[model samples]
Target: MGVRALMNDLTGSKSDKSECWMSLRAPELFRVMEKIDKEYALVRKDAQKYIEKIDFNKRMLEVVLAEATVAYQEVYKAGPLYARIPGGLPLGGPCMMKLPDTVLFFHRMKLRNDTFLRVNVLHNDMVNMVLRAHLSVYGLHLKGAYDHTTTGQVRGTLVHTPTAGELGIFLEDIKYTIEGRYRFMGDRLVIELIVSTLSIRNMALKYPNATDSDPPVRLLKKNMADFRTGLKTDLDKWVQDYFNGYLIVADLQDIPSLWKLREYDQYKTSKLAAFTDLAVARINKRILDIGGDYIRVPKFKIVAAYGLVINIYDGALRGLDTMYRRSVATTVFKRDNLRYVDAIIGFKDLEVSYRYVVNFPPGPLMPPSLTGVLRMSAKDLTAHLSLGLLMDPEVVELDINFINPPGPDDITIEGAANILMSNFKHILRYEIATIMSNSLMYGVGLLRTLPRCEPFVPGMLRNTTKLGKFNKKKTLSTSSKNSDEARSKESNYTRPQRRHGTTVKMMQDIGTK
Candidate 1:
């Protein structure tokens, strides 16, 4: 109040015309101007902080853009245009999501190549026997040898044309629709080709147990065969009706008698269903014996895809006693060019042990003794590839270098243990390396010799391509009951369980009918 009164007095004291106008201003106007200045100061402080934050965000965005540019350039420099895609290797494990049948692109898969068909021994004979039994199950008996060769050589040709990415395979005497599904595990691609539907093309002429000697039997056979020949539709439904109504349900009691003459219980099992099942089991057993159940894809193929392939499956390199101990291995390309690509394998965490015997001729208080556990741990081990024009891949050079070289501390034994340990490690290192190389080569050799036409059938009849061989002598000789029983015993056959209960239902329907 004192200051305001003093300021009023001063304005009143001024009598000049210009000074008199200043005295006319109210006190409320000065208060309002002061309030506006205080508000502006608070807002200016907050606005400065916001500007700094904006600058920081701009710098971060620029850095991200620069990194993206470099990544794009490197990918451009990589192999093909497809390789630049997200699923490309070194990082793209299997890259399977891009396509249905294959990872990137799988053009075609043909089973029996006519130009270079490599049919295995006995494939034909097994096929013919199985077909004969299958037809017999449906009461369709073809007279004179049910020779498959007359129609086609059981030549299973799988043709995948450009029109669709479908796989068509001819499994000797039977026809089935196949579908493929795939998955990625670590660095490998596993494709499961499964049967979607079952079908039959060639029909039978005569009903089971029908004899050619009888007039009605001969007439029945002729009429059925002729009727089947004229029909241009799928025979599955017709065969099902024929089997359920006339063949199996009516002759259920006579099954034993009918098969008795055929010697069908080759497996010696009480659960023998039909001669067809027995033949199927025999073929399954044979495949198991030959190690066709599990097929390890040649690692080189994966190597080419990824450029660097890592396999935790130590089995391939386990042939070497020492190499078997420390198991992780990686196959990588050392160099790549238009002429050729150089690949090498690198091993990690390698540890090998050896045993030695030292002889000290009765010196003072000593005798011959054996030393235990002379251990050597390799710091690094590498192998170079030497591939020629062969179906298999091979490693030519193996260099084993230790991170911690062998020291006296490695041996606990007393007398000339150092000398023995040194010699042992030296020989063991190279021996293991050589064995590991050969082991890898052996696996590749199998991949080369074994048919690449399809994945090996994991189980007999379960996942079979049904492609097989034919032989008139074998088929005819094995038809007798005594021969079938003897063969079944030899085969140790097991009846396969149908995945879909379609057959069981069909049988039930037939019984009801």
Candidate 2:
């Protein structure tokens, strides 16, 4: 009441006091407050947009998973039997070793068998979807930060982290192709899958700014280099493991050289043998359980052989032209010391191949002789070749032809043939294992490298305003409490004032009373 009365008395009216209060507020402050409100509205709008984008990406991921599921079902229909005997052999049969009349014949048969074409189609589609999703997330992050810079908006600090579009540059214009070939050799069905041209150099070149010397760029480059190295190493290891797995067949073990190779178990070779043993056992058990009368063979003799050959064409070597000659002069080639030279140098292409073979006994519809099997008419042989063999030929030979005939100086045809004959089995095993391992790791790596989409919430982007409101409330409450405490202390310290002559009178009155 005291302050209000004093203000009214001085100003002459309550309306005058209100006018004074309004005059005291600066116009600039009101304008600044208005600008802040507008900025906040913009921030909210941006956050809403980001949320919508995330929801769209989530839907895309669901679609991708659905497609992948359908593809997996097709592949699953064949069962583990297809993986074990990739060459699409009948239920019970001896292994087909010789090269068929044409590679096309086996390829067509594989399509007709339980091995589904839809599997490959699904894989390709899934990969593309994953890649697109990763890019979309990354692009959003970049745009959000860049928008803040242009509009003078203060997004949360975490959003400002520069992504620089590294993943986009790596994946752009890159294609994933899977080529499969099926061949029958010895007691194994050779299934070969070639995944062609996975590299980032071309994409990197396209977007030079993305690979600038920034910290994020440097880190990404280092990670990619390490991944590439790991892939090559893992590919080699896979080749070894897969080869050992297929070599578990009883007939193959009879080779003296193979027996000696098996003794090198310093690197947990026992684990490889155990894995193959378990796999083979499971396949046999499944056959017996399902194909009771259909399978008349004493036992299912089948081998799944896989091979991976990564042919790396070196651009640097191409430029040097004479580097191969120089290396040959300086380096001594040892037969036992098999090492990959292409890995040390960058490769332009990678070739992968896998093979599976199944062996079954002669059946009512199938003959025991190869000649008899091949001699049957088209209609009769169709059923036999499709399900069983009409004839079992005693002698089947593999004819080798060179695409580009080698000169005598480089390597005689006879010498090349001899070398191939000596190392064919070993090479086949190594390639198969490497390809399988590489494919497995490659899929895992692709998934791992996908960028995560951060959830878009209002708090994430508009944190500054929320924090400001909290701080303002805390400041107002603390100031108000301090002012009340100060007033009380002041009142306690000051004595009550008496009238001009009341000091002496007050004492006299108190005495009289």
Please provide TM-scores, in order, for all candidate models, with all chains considered together: 0.16, 0.15
lDDT of the candidates, in the order given = 0.24, 0.21
**How would you encode candidate 2's per-residue C-alpha lDDT over 1-513 as one tens digit per residue?**
487664443333333222111111112222333343354444334433543445532332334334334453453564321111122321101001011110000000011122211112221111111111111101101110010001012111001111222121122222222221212234332322112222333312122254455433222232232232222222223322333344234132222233222222111223322322332232222222222101110111112222211111110101100001100000111122111111011112121112222122335653222110100001100000000001111111111111111111221122122333332333222222222222222211221111111111112122344334423432322343234234334333221221112211211121111
Give Cα distance to truth, residue 121, candidate 1, Å.
51
What is the TM-score of candidate 2?
0.15
Runs off by more than 4 Å, candidate 1: 1-339, 387-513
Model 1 over residues 1-513: C-alpha lDDT tens digits?
A: 487774454334333121101111222222332343354444333433443445422332223223324453453455211101111111101000111122111121122221111111111011001111122111122212110101012121111122222222222233332221211122222221111233334432232344766333222221121122111112322322222232122111222232331222122111212211322233233334344433221111111111221111212211111121121111111222101111222333333333334333345654345344333333244332211111111111111211112222322333355545453342223222222222232222222212122222222122233323211211223333224344334434322222222222221221111
lDDT of 1: 0.24
lDDT of predicted model 2: 0.21
**Considering every candidate listed, which one attains the maximal lDDT?**
1
Given candidate 2, what's the lDDT at residue 52? 48
Q: Which 10 consecutive residues of model 1 have the lowest summed lDDT?
A: 88-97
Q: Show where candidate 2 strays beyond 4 Å.
A: 1-201, 204-223, 233-244, 256-513
Model 1 — TM-score against the truth? Answer: 0.16
lDDT of 1 at 24: 17
